[model samples]
Target: MSQPADYRDPRSLRSRERIIRALRAELRAGRSLTIAAVTGEAKVTRQTFYNNFDSLEEAGWFALLEDFNTLLVDDIQTRWSGASPDFVGLASLRKIVELLRAESSLSLLANGYRDEAGLTGLAAVMLSEIRRFRAEFGDPASPLAQEEDLYTATGLCGLLTVAATGDASSTSIARAAYALLPEWMRQPRL
Candidate 1:
């Protein structure tokens, strides 16, 4: 029996890459992704899109997460290259909340309260990125290191959901969410 094609396959990777590029283009152009829009942007058939992603929302989630995190992580590194790792990550997260607030309409649409399925998908992506960042900065000896993945996923999801709701929260979200980080990961007073 032959192995099935996976994302690692060259052609499959190319197809997925085009689909993601198309998704990003639609979002950057401030267009909602109708099937036609995605297919047109990707220059691939509708069937190709479906083959790579289960739904349009899933594709959007992947594209959004990839673009957002790539920029955010780079910004964090540039701003705090000399600072301790945890400080940089914490600051970056606060910045993320601010950016989300600034892009209120887009954030609201992705929040998915009106569309429960979308909420789950977006939250999953958010949690995955946040948790990955946390682990990168996490203290190996801290209790947090041994906790289940749900610790960061559920906690950050809840925090971000709340942050998304407050219209006047850009400045305050940083300290609020930063306080939730494990004690060992926090920056000490000067």
Candidate 2:
């Protein structure tokens, strides 16, 4: 017997991409980020938007995390040369600055628009990412490594927050974040 034909719709995928792009455009333009604005900009209906995401803030966070994952997860080896801790930190910061320069609006909107609970949630997410990165690449067996990971993640998040809310350039913010990285990341695994 012949198999049934597959049924799939590409319109939903296209609509999702359009919605994300519209959200980014709104962020870049420093315009109001409302469902109506995003739906209008995306030229997709509210039903389409809701189909993709629950809310505008959810969409923004998804985009921000997606960008960071692309940079951190996809290019881990190339970006992280297991050399001196300072070198890795600087290189990572440089790459982050490049990302921020390319599309900082997402970060700005994600960090700036959130309330206390939202900000706490974002921090927790960032902390989890840092812990995962350490477990994957650094010395997770050491207690010091765990503590250092928390410190570095907290400091970096603070720096990003300051840069997002203040007038500091991303380059400067990255430099500050780089300084917060501990040298223990280069410690040899026992």
- For this target, which candidate reaches the highest lDDT against the unseen true structure? 2
Return the lDDT, model 1, position 175: 66
Q: Give a tens-digit lDDT track for model 2, residues 1-190.
A: 0111321457766777798899998888989889999999999888878877766766776677676666667445653444554455566666666665566667655554343444432454466667666766667787677567666766777766656555676567767776676654433232
**True-vs-predicted CA distance for residue 183, candidate 1, Å:** 2.4
Q: In model 2, which range of ten residues has the least summed lDDT? A: 1-10
Using TM-score as the measure, the top candidate is 1
Global lDDT scores for all candidate models: 0.61, 0.65
Residue pairs with clashing backbones, model 1:
none
In candidate 1, how many Å is residue 91 off? 2.3
Model 1: per-residue lDDT, tens digit, 1-190?
Answer: 0121576888877888898787667766888758789889989888878777766666655655665677557844654556775656566677677666555444543444222333354466655665554555544455545463445555666787677567655556766766676564465222
Residue 145 shift from truth in candidate 2, angstroms: 7.3
